[model samples]
Target chain A: MSQALLTVIGEDRPGIVAAVTQALFTADCSIGDASMMRLGGYFTIMQVIDYPRDLGSVEMALDPAIKRLNLRVHLDPISSVALTADMPNTRVTVYGADHPGIVAGVTGALAAIGFNVIDLESESSGSAERPLYVMVIQGYAPEGVESVRKAVVPLREREGVEIGVHPIEAAVF
Target chain B: MAVLSILTYPDPRLQRKAEPVSVFDDDLHHFIDDLTETMYAGPGGVGIAAPQVDRPQRIVIVDVRPKLGEDCHGLMVLINPELAAWEGMAVGREGCMSVPDFTGNVIRAERIQVQAQDASGRERSYECEGFEARAIQHEMDHLDGFLFLDRLVSRKIDLFRRKQYQK
Candidate 1:
């Protein structure tokens, strides 16, 4: 079996998921892992699919649905790899006044230290006059927790944001 | 006392509702010891329930003191514990030994008053706050066959796979 990664972005509306999944079903592709969410005014979907056919066939199958939904679709062949296990996961949260370089400055610091961002979400709240930006990032840090904290200090100062990095502990019953 | 093996998700036994502990005898004492040993033996474990070890009884052991230091009430052995009063709400990420390999954001009461019987079968009550309250609530859920996954704030965003534990 071959694996493919598909990302669909379009205006927020109902039935987008159903239409996309129906197209994948018609193509005989099975979804492995998927995440769909509404970010501001747009809906975004990221999915990993397993299929017996080639990449072109999967893309062709989704073409009509993509066009009808007025969605932007990006498809690529991906290697079927198992998820990393036993890696330390930390949640890094950054919040402060709305600024243009918050994402880049914060993520750049983490990326420089080889941290892999597994999940991220950000939103701007408050008011137009005094907007606040909040970003929550869940990532795996190979260098451990202290290193991650130390790495973000520069970004914290430069971005003028409150940054907190906490280890995600799972409670054993 | 023995450090019993913790039951993981889909184990069937973890789903079984635990019956209230009525006759607090030698067996009950021994079981509580086992539960305590199991909780301490597990890395970073602050609480545990009898059902996690395949024993369906309303008995749980919580000791956030080791991790929380002077801020906690040391080891808390709650038998047939009940939530008497609760106020406020807060969301905290929780992972369970019985549901290994995953964690989720769970909204629990910020402060709670729990009424329970001690291991000696004496009636007792404790007013706990913060992390202690969260741990107690987490262990208590096991008595009702509820995992942290059931209380997740949002499955779409809050649920996450368990990775390495960082100190």
Candidate 2:
């Protein structure tokens, strides 16, 4: 079996997933992991699938379904890699008035200290005249948590954003 | 005391509702010992429910004293525990041993009153606030076959990867 990354993007509408997934089903491909959501009136899908046959055949099979849904699809054959079960130990949240380089400024500080970002989500809300940007990041810091926290202090001051770094403790119950 | 194996998710047994403790005998005592050992053996383990170990009984052990120090009520062994009253609300992140690989935000009562029996079969009642209250609520949910995933405020936003973050 081979692994393939599939991405689908099109105007938000019903039946987009049904059509795309139905095509994969018909091609005898099994979805391993998938995420589908709508962002700014556009529906997007990112999925990893396992196919018994070659990548070209899978693309050929999905072409008709893509055309019928009026969607853009990208398919790439990717090497399968072993996934680790390590969990993130820290959570960083930054939110404040919208700015030009908040993401770069914050993430750059994190990267400098060898902190790996495991997940991040950012959104701009409120009215256009007074926009608010919020970014939540979950990651691991091998260089010690205090060092990472101190490094981002400058970004917080310059960007005038509220920043908090908390230890992620998941109590077993 | 022995540390029993913890049952992980996708196990049909984890979904089954635990039975109430009708007889508080020596067997029940031993079971609680093993359960306590198992809970402490887990990484950052603070509590354990009987059902998690595949014993369908209404028993749970918790000790937030280690985490909260003198601020906590120490180790508590609640048998047939039930919530009597609760007040306030707070959202906290929780992860379960039975349901590994993910964590989620859960809104629980900030303060709670519970009634239950001790290991000696003596009736007891206690009021717990803050983190202790949250842990009790979480463990009690297991007795009714409810995982933290069921109480998540929102699946799309509340659920998060346990160790890694991916878009």
Candidate 3:
């Protein structure tokens, strides 16, 4: 029932995951949740892993493995305490002609209003006719959606692009 | 007709290629009614395919007009559709009932021309663009036994956290 968070970042290369995961498996660690990505030349990973209840306590066990990987590792033993889960959130996707400061300006406004962003993904597409910048942001309003609605209005006016925000609840199969 | 239970993933029924309608029969009509009812009953579900309702037939109902600002042509029922040709690729995040609890970036054709049959057995061709095209393509993939998961660009780019709503 002990949980730990592991993050791995390095130059994009094969066997990085295999090396890291093999270490976890050898230690009898079970990966509970994880995400890995390749951004240009960098590879990054974030994961939550669980270990046996009596696995050599927290700091003592993870140090040697951290040194061996020659990778930055952070470990925080999860507490049994329960934190109130945040309200379910939604996603908004915006894409149009590319322009400067799109991400900084939009994200700046969002962060100002205390809207917690869960994930934000962006990509560029289109040919010479008009290069496009597309961004999809998944965020939540812990205080409720009214503030989120108000905060985004000015963005729409200044950005000259449409923003679509909908409350999305994950469907359980 | 009543709201039918949506068949989710891990249901072997969703993976099989849907059978084409051979002859117009009462069974076909009944399936259409159920699909319509199920589409409307689900929250924000603008379309439904036969495989979603366990019928394994090539049929779909779509109505995107309700999505604000989308302003798409309303109410289309496509039966036994064939993709003639399509142009352009668009990467967009798509979610499905079958895969519930996940959404991923999928690259799909932005404009498509399809030939299909209507309820009355009339041959019809459609030139669709924008969101309508996306919905049509999503539904048609079901007929071919393909899900949005198969079209994911990369696991790193499109995965998201499941949001919960507060009372």
Candidate 4:
């Protein structure tokens, strides 16, 4: 078993990550995977750090750091299910006049079909004269399926927009 | 007739800058045929470039016609196409076969007009907007030895890996 999941969120500034990492280091915690991003005024950090498997030592390992950093920490035992199996790359693209429900409709459709939305990014700009809304979503197509063709027909019709799906580049290591 | 193997990244051949297709001859036609076959042979690809199939020549084949709806039929265009004009801005998360295993944020033009020749040897120019335009520009960059990796602006952070090579 790996360590607990560690998430820290606060204002963005120099040494926030360093301060948190320094605390983890002193406690001898191993980081599994992590990501930090900033939106407008807030900086957020999410990490999966591994600790000894013993449940007894879990709180002992994490409490000191949580107290020292003054950052909120959520600790959950890492399970085998946390490790997602590699799946084939699948892509979803949506385009329409910039409007609401574009994302909800598309993402809702994907969820209905059992598609996992691994990553998504969207941007909309330009005036009403030439408004453009574009989104790219990457996912994994279910195994044993030869195609996702016709899967997005309802999405296209309901959203009144263009929706495209194709298998993403399969990276053979 | 040859169905050349589509080279994934790190093959070294994919990194070469293709020479301009000055020969509008039989060899060029053959190259186009191979590129078409290669594009269709992949899982589901809408475009292919000369460099992708190990031939470093200024040629690209794009067929968004298949992706078009019943109201619109996509065209399988052969472009020696030069981008003539562009406007607006777009940020997208894109991935490529050359840079397999990763996807990144890429910023590109929203609309463009490209002047070029079709598959039939007659000269034609395409005024592309939206997805078609983006794909055209993306594939055209291959002729100059550019991959989508060069356009990446950021990573998903959590998705980042220690060793990210196109192997």
Root-mean-square deviation per candidate? 5.4, 5.3, 7.6, 9.4
Locate the minimum summed-lDDT window of 10 residues in model 4 chain A.
Answer: A164-173
A best-first ranking of the candidates according to their lDDT comes to 2, 1, 3, 4
RMSD of 4: 9.4
The lDDT of each candidate is 0.85, 0.85, 0.73, 0.67
Give i-RMS (Å) per prediction: 3.6, 3.4, 6.0, 7.7
Order by TM-score, highest first: 2, 1, 3, 4
Candidate 4 achieves a global lDDT of 0.67
Better of 1 and 2 by TM-score: 2
Off by over 4 Å in 1: A82-88, A112-114, A151-158, B1-8, B11-13, B37-45, B64-72, B84-92, B109-112, B127-132, B154-167
In model 2, the runs with Cα more than 4 Å from the true position are A84-87, B1-8, B19-30, B37-45, B65-71, B84-95, B100-113, B121-131, B152-156, B159-167
Model 4 agreement with the true structure over A105-172: per-residue lDDT tens digits: 77776666677777786657558798988777777766412344456787677778887766554211
Task: Residues A1-173, candidate 3: write the lDDT tens digits.
Answer: 67777777777777677877776776778897688777677778888878775545433455554465556666666654565656447666666678887787777877887877877778676786788888888787765566666777888878876676666543211
Worst 10 residues of 3 chain B by lDDT: B158-167
Lowest lDDT sum, 10 consecutive residues, model 4 chain B, at: B158-167
Better model by DockQ, 1 or 2? 2
Error of 4 at B54 (Å): 1.8
How do the residues B1-167 of candidate 2 rate in per-residue lDDT, one tens digit apiece? 99999898888898888888889889988988889889989865788899999998889888887688878878899999989988877567899998887888787888889899999889999899989999999999989989999988843354232333111
True contacts kept of each: 0.58, 0.72, 0.03, 0.00
